[model samples]
Target: MSEPKRMGRMGRRPGHGPGGGMMPGEKAKNFKGTVRKLIQYMGKYKIAILAVLTFAVASTAFGIAGPKILGQATTELFNGLVAKVSGTGEIDFGKIGRILLFLICVYAFSALCSFVQGWIMTGVTQKVCFRFREDISSKINRMPMKYFESRTVGEVLSRITNDVDTLGQGLNQSVTQLITSVATLIGILIMMLSISPVMTLIALVILPLSGILIGIVVKFSQKYFVAQQKYLGEINGQVEETFSGHNIVKAFNKEEDMLKEFHGTNDMLFQSAWKSQFLSGMMQPIMGFVGNLGYVAVAVAGGMLVVRGSIEVGEIQSFIQYVRQFTQPITQVAQVSNMLQSTAAAAERVFEFLGEEEEDLTAEHPVKLENMEGRVSFEHVQFGYRPDQVIIHDFNCQVKPGQTVAIVGPTGAGKTTMVKLLMRFYDVNQGSIQVDGHDLRDFNRSELRENFGMVLQDTWLFKGTIMENIRYGRLDATDEEVVAAAKAAHAHRFISTLPGGYEMELNEDASNVSQGQKQLLTIARAILADNPILILDEATSSVDTRTEERIQRAMNNLMKGRTSFVIAHRLSTIKDADVILVMKDGDIIEQGSHQELLAQHGFYAELYNSQFEAA
Candidate 1:
C-alpha cells in the first residue's frame, strides 16, 4: 500500500503548553553548524530574505519614531495649558491636530511595511519547505534499504513532516522577530538617549541582568528539549507499530502491555515537555520584572532631571515609554533565542537525513542488454546484512534461460536473502552474481530491476482502484491488457463478484479485500508486468486448494519461457520437471530435479514428508 499521507499527530498532544510553536528544551548538538547549513540551504532565496530583513527594519524604525513624535504633541499641549492659565496665550489646536495626524500616518506606514515583510517572509519560508520535502522524497528512493530497515517509518517520516514544518515556522517567525527586536532595541535606545542620557543609562543597566537570566534558563532547559524531541519520535513509532499490528496485538491479548508501553513513553514525553516549556516560560516574567525595575529607575532619574530643569516634562514621558519598549524587545529577543534553538534542532534532523549515504545507482558505463535471455549465475556468492555476520556462505548456482528453479527450505535458510542479492538490493560481500555474463554491478540498478518482475509475499496495493493497482505493474498497459492479465491469474472472477468490479477504491491499507484476493491482485500485477525474469515468493500460498490449482496453472502459463525462481514451502505444488535447491541454515544442501532430490531423501525429503504429515 502507499505510505500514509499524513501519519500520526505526535506533535499535537493533550496538555500541551501555550506558545507551543517551539519546544524550548530541544537544543541542537551543533547549533552554529546547523544554522550555517540552514543558511546555505536557503542561499537560493537570499534576495528574498534580504528584502524581508530590510522591510522589517524599516517597519520597526517607523514604529519607533511614533512615541518620540507623540511626545512633541504632549509638550505643546503642556506649554499651551501653562500659557492659557496665565491668560498670556490660548492652546494651539491647529498645531496639536497636525501632530496627531502625523503620528497616525507614521503608525500606518509602519503597519504597511510590516505586512509587506510578512508576506515576503511567508513565501520564502514555504518555498524552502517545499524544496525540503521534494529533496527528501527523492533522497528516499536512492537511499539503501538497510537505512530504512534500521529506523522506524515514523522516525523517517518525522523528517519530512514535523521537522520541516517546525523549521519553516521557526524561520518565518524568528527571522522577522529577531530583526525587529534588535532594530526596536537600537531605535528606542537612541530616542531615549536623545531625551535624557541619565535615564537611558539607567534603562540600559537592566540588559546584562536579563541576559544572565535568559542564559541560565536556556542552559538548564536545553537537555529537556532534546529529550522531548526524542520521545516524540519514539511515541510516534510506538503508535504506528501498535496500530499497524493491532490485530496481532489483540490476537496475543497484549492490550495492557501495549498500554503500559505507551504510557511509559507518554510519561517521558510529558515530563520533558513540561520541564522545557516551564523553564522557557520563565523568561517572559523574569524579563518583565527586570523591565519594571528599569522603569522605576528611569522614572526616578527622569523626575530628578526634570526638577533640575534639565529635561522637559513630555521628554520624561517619552523616556518612560522608551524604557518600556526597550524591555519588550529584550523579552522578544529571549523568546526568539528559544525559537532559534528549536529551529536549529529541527534543521539538524532534516540535514542529517539529507546527508545519509545514498546508494550509487549510476554505473560509470552501464551495460544494456538488447535481448535479455535471463541466463543467471551465482559464483561462490557470500553475503550478510552486516559484514561481520555472514548468512549466505559460498552459494554457487547457474540457471539456463526458460528454467524454473524452486528454492525449498525451512525459515532462516537465506532463501529471501538470495532474492535480494539477485535483485542487487544489497551487493554481495564476496564473489559475484551475473546475468547473461554481465555482472549485476555493471548494469544500472534501475535497468537491472526493469528486467525482473516480483510478486512478494506481502502484497502492496496502494489507495486506488483494483484496475489501477494492477496497472501499476505496467503503467502504459491498456484496460483490455489489464483484464487479460487478471484473467490469467484467476483474479477476474473474484474482482467481477466485488461491488465495484475493477473500480472499487482501496483504502490506505487495502483492508477491504481478503488476503487471498490481495495475493491474486499482486499475481495479476506480476503477470501484467510480463518481465523476462520472475521471482514469486509464496505466490499461491494464500488461496484455497481449488483456487490454488487454477492459480498454479496460470503461474505455469506465466512462467513458461521466463526464468523463474519459485520460493515455496508447499513441496507438492513444485513437483515438476525443474531444478530444486534444498537449503538448511544458510547453505544449499541438495540441488537436482524433484524426483532425484526425493530419491536422495536429504533435507528436501524430510521437509516434504513433514508438511504432508502435518496436513
Candidate 2:
C-alpha cells in the first residue's frame, strides 16, 4: 500500500518489501486517495451514472408536487362540506369531480416516476459493482509475492466480497432517497413561506436543532463503523484459518481451541456492528418525532391566522404538507451520512490494494529472453529477509549451461535462497545475479521467470484432475503434450490405473493421493513447462526410498540438457552433481566434486558421512 516503490532510491525502504519496515498503518495513505480514485472507476459508465441522477431528481419533483395538489383538494372538500351542513347546501358537482380527477392523476404520475427511478438505479448499481469486482480481480493478478505474504487469505477475500457488497447495497438504496429528500425539502420550503412568514419561521426553528443532533451522532457513528470493519476483517481471517487448518486442528484435538478463537472474533464483530447500527438507526424516528412537534405548532398558529383572515384555509393545509416534506430531508440527511462513511471506508480498502507496490519489473524497453541456455552466476551477492540477520553474505557461485549443481548444508544455510535469487522473487541487497552474460535487473520479470521450473520439498497439487494440474504448467499445451510429460515424470502408469485415469479428481490439496504421487504430478507439470533451467528444493525428501528412486528417474529425465539446482539434504541426490557446494550461514564453506570434497574431509564430507553412517 505504500507508493509504487521508489525505483530511483528516494526514501526509507518499506519494511514489508525491500528498504525497511513500513509505518504501522501505512496502508491508510492509499485509503486517503480512495474517493478520488473510485470516482475514476465510474468513467467507463458515466452515462449510466448520470442517468440515475437525472431520474432521481425528476421523480422527487413529481412525487413532492403530487402531495401539494392533494393538500389543496382536501381543503376545498372540507370547506364545501361545512357550507352544505350550514344549509346553504348545494355542493358543486363540477368542483368535486375535478378534484377527484386531479387526485387520481397525481397518484398515477407518482407511480410512473417511481418505475423510471427504479430502472436507472438498477443500471447504475450493476455498473458500479462490475467495475469494483473487475478492478479488484485484475489487481490480484498483477500483485506480487509479498502482498500475499503480508496478508491472510481471509482478509483478501473479505475485501473482494464483503466490502464490495456493502458498498453496492448502500449506494443503490441511498442515492435515490437522498435526491428525493433534498428536492422535496426545497419545494416544500417555498410553499410554506408563501403561506405565512411567521408560521414558516416557527416550523423551521426546530430544523437546525435536528441538524445539530444528527451531526453529533454522525461523528461518533463513524468511529464505530471503522471498528466494525476491523473486526469483520478479523472474523474473516479466523474463518479462513479454521477451514485451511481443519485437518491439523482435528489431528491435534484442538477443535475446542479453534472454536474459542472463532467465537471471540465473532463476538467482537457483533459488538462493533451493534454499536454502529444503534446510532444510525436512531436518526429517522427521532427526527420524525421532532418534526411532528413542529407540525402541531404550525397548525395552531395557522388556525388563528385563518380566523383573522390572514391566511387562506387551503394555504394552511398546503403548509402542513410542506412541514411533512421538510421533515423527510432531515431524516434522510442523517441516514445518508452513514452510507457515505460506509462507502468511504470500502473505497479506502479497495484503493489501498490498487495502490500497493509490486517488485519493480521493467515494463518499457524490457530485456527480452530468447532461447535461454541457462548459465547462472551469483557475484558477491548479499541478501537478507531481516535487517538483523543476513542470510546470504558475499556469496559467489556459478553453473555453466547444461550443468547439474547441488547445494547442501544445515537448515537455514541459504540453499533455498539461491534458488529464490535465481527466480528473482526477491532482489539482492548488494551485488548481482546474472543469467548468461546479462544482469538479472535487465530482464523482464515474467520473461526471466519463464526460463526456470521448480519443484519444492512441499509439493503443491490443487484439487483437480491430474491432467488439469499438469496443464497448469503451460496453459496453451495440448492434451497429448500433457500425457507425454506425465509419462516422462513416471506418473502415467498410476494415473492410468485410477478410476478416471488422468481425468481423476483429487481431494483438497490432492490429499487422496500419496505424497509421492503429488510430488510426481508437480514434477510432471515442470516437465510439461519445458524450460531450460530447473530447481529442485529438497524435492524427494518427503518420498519413501523406492519413491525417491522413481522421482530421481523423473528428475533425471527433466534435467537432461538443462541447467539445474538441487538443494537436497539426502547426500544421495548430490553425489552425482557436476559440482557440490556446502553452505553455512549464507556463505559457501566448501566447494568441489562429491569425491573431491569427501577426500578433503570438511563440512560436506562430515555431512555425507553422518547421513551414510545413519543408513
Tens-digit lDDT string for candidate 1 (285-397): 98888888887887888788878999887887787788878878877887898789989998998999899999879899999998799999989999989889999999999
lDDT string for model 2 (1-615, tens) is 000111211121112112122111223344437656766776776777677677767767666676567666666777778889997766676786787788777777777777877787777777787887898888876677668655545466656776677667767777777777777788677777767889989988978888888778878887787777677756665665567667888999998998898898888889989999999898777787788888899999989998998976777777887887787676776567657666667667766777787567664567776688889888999998776778888889888998899999999899888877787777888999989888888887878888888888667766788888899888899999999998887889889998889889997657788878887888888889888988888878777888788878878877889999999988987788898989999999999899999999898888888986855
TM-score of 2: 0.83
Weakest ten-residue segment in model 2 by summed lDDT: 1-10
Candidate 2, residue 480: how far the Cα is off, in Å: 2.8
| TM-score versus the correct structure, for each prediction | 0.90, 0.83
Candidate 2: misplaced stretches above 4 Å? Answer: 1-33, 40-47, 87-89, 92-97, 103-118, 140-144, 208-285, 312-318, 363-370, 385-390, 461-464, 506-515, 612-615
**Runs with alpha carbons beyond 4 Å of true place in candidate 1:** 1-24, 207-286
Q: Could you tell me which residue pairs clash in candidate 1?
A: 25-225, 26-225
Residue 260, candidate 2: Cα error in Å is: 6.5
Per-candidate Cα RMSD to the true structure, in Å, reads 4.1, 6.4
